[model samples]
Each structure stands twice: as structure tokens, then as C-alpha cells.
Target: MPNNIKFVKESKSKFLTTKEYHGYGQILKISDDGIEKHIVVKPKDPVFGITIKFLETGHPQFSIPDVSIDETAIMLKNLEEAKTFCREFYERRDEFVQDAI
Candidate 1:
């Protein structure tokens, strides 16, 4: 598991708060799911932050040595579909953040 995780100087993972393409930044807020761990991603911009419980497949094994959302956990079957959800959530960030405040 440790081998899969990227280490930054100050932050934890390399993807901790970085946007993949020419997009706004993002942060990975991690959560525990009993035996497994999950994550909720938050955008750096003033968009709505998202909390997600992973819908995962397969089982954990020590021989695997690493884990990741894209590889292990799944919210949507297609990558493009997942991005769509993020964009839509970001658009409504104001409402979500406001209510939380």
C-alpha cells in the first residue's frame, strides 16, 4: 500500500491537491471504511467540495502492495462519467459549502 502512495515534501500524496490537466486544484480527503480506506475529493477553487463513499470491487491482499481509487475503488464504471459528476458537483459548490457553513 505504501509503495503506491506518492510522497510530497509537505503534503502527503502527490495527487493530494493537484488537478490533473489544466484545471483547478484538488485535495483528497481520506476516510476509513473499516478494513478498507476511501476518499472524498475537494476542489481548490471555491467550488463545492465532495464527500464520497467508495463503491469498490475485489478484495484486499497483502501481495498486491498498493491501492488507489482509480484502480481499486469505483464510483462510476467510466472515467469520463466520473469527471462529469465532479464538474457538476463543482458547479453547485456554493450551495453545498453554504449549507455546511
Candidate 2:
């Protein structure tokens, strides 16, 4: 188990909040109790283009380094399908940030 989770930064939106764990290179959405969801944009396996996982609070895999795809995960074939899933289910939006410009 990881002794600690080092977060580099966090971004909050109306729909969800994301935290980037240092050295992990993945964005996580944690609930008040524990991790709720996470997205792996560039998975090591080309077969699974983007992996979106919805984990229950206090799940054993929460603290593990291995990536387990069970019934709660949806492996999208490509970026476009992943975006569509987010738009429909998560209601994602493309917002322009002035500070980033």
C-alpha cells in the first residue's frame, strides 16, 4: 500500500473534481469518503484506448497499484467514444480558461 498520496494539483468543476496524483499520471475524482471515479487517458495497452473506472468507497483496489477492470469500468475504444460517453453520462463541457491562454 502507498504510504501517502502526493497530489500535484486539483481542478474542480460543477460536475466533478479532479486531483492529479504526483508520479501516478492519472486524474482521480474522490468523494468525501473515498475515491469515486478516475480516468486513464493513455493506457499502456493500445487495445483499451481510454479506461474510465467507477469505484465504490473503500474498495480494496483503491490503494493498489494494479489496474483492475471489473464490472464498474468502461473501456472505450478511442478518444471520440470516451468523449461521447462523458458528454452523455457526465455532461462534460469544453470551457475556455482565460488564465490558460
Candidate 3:
């Protein structure tokens, strides 16, 4: 957690279901000076997704698609190109799946 971070609650409506929900989030702490900072959070798993945190506060700014399958495929292809590259790089790789980006 950064020193200049704060959490905020937001009310949002669920699409289709038409239900309302309250979510907790954080963002960079705003100072009296009125300056805002940029915060970026990258999830470990590109396929699952990533969360972006605003620097002005610690709250989550937004979520991004992981596209892990696509990215990992590309990575695997690149690794294959290098014959000397160890195949172990992708073996038993399930543990590396990241839920956030």
C-alpha cells in the first residue's frame, strides 16, 4: 500500500439483472495542492485480467482483459523458435496464472 492511497466506495448497477451493488476501491490520496498521480497495476495472468489503480488514490481504476491464451501462445511460439530454450519454461505452468493485471 502506498502512503498516498485511499479507498472509496462506489455504487453501480448490474447490467441485465438490474441489481445494484456497492464496491470498495482505493485511489491515490489527493492533496490540497490538487495534483493527481497515475497508478498502474499489472496482473500476473494476462488471460484472467488486470486491475488499474489510480495514483491519486489507491482505489481500483478499472479492469483490463488478460488475453493470456493469446499472449501465452505467442510466448510459447517464441520459446519454440529458440531450440536451445528449455521446454521447462512452460511446463507445469498452471501455477503462473495471474488473476489480475
What is the alpha-carbon lDDT of model 1 when measured against the actual structure?
0.32
Estimate the Cα RMSD of every predicted model relative to the unseen true structure. 16.8, 14.3, 17.5
User: Estimated TM-score per prediction?
Assistant: 0.27, 0.27, 0.23
Question: Cα miss at 10, model 1 (Å)?
Answer: 32
Pairs of residues clashing in candidate 1: 1-65, 48-93
Query: After TM-score superposition, what is the CA distance of residue 97 in candidate 1 from its true location, in Å?
Result: 0.7
Native-structure RMSD, model 3: 17.5
lDDT of 2 by residue, 1-96 (tens): 222223456666666665443222233333221233443323333444454454222121212223346612434234444444334323221121
Between candidates 1 and 3, which one is better according to TM-score?
1
Model 3 stretches astray by more than 4 angstroms: 1-39, 66-101
Judging by lDDT against the true structure, name the best candidate.
Answer: 2
Tens-digit lDDT string for candidate 3 (14-94): 421111111122121212212321223333334443334442232324454435665766444433322111122123112
Candidate lDDT values, in order? 0.32, 0.34, 0.28
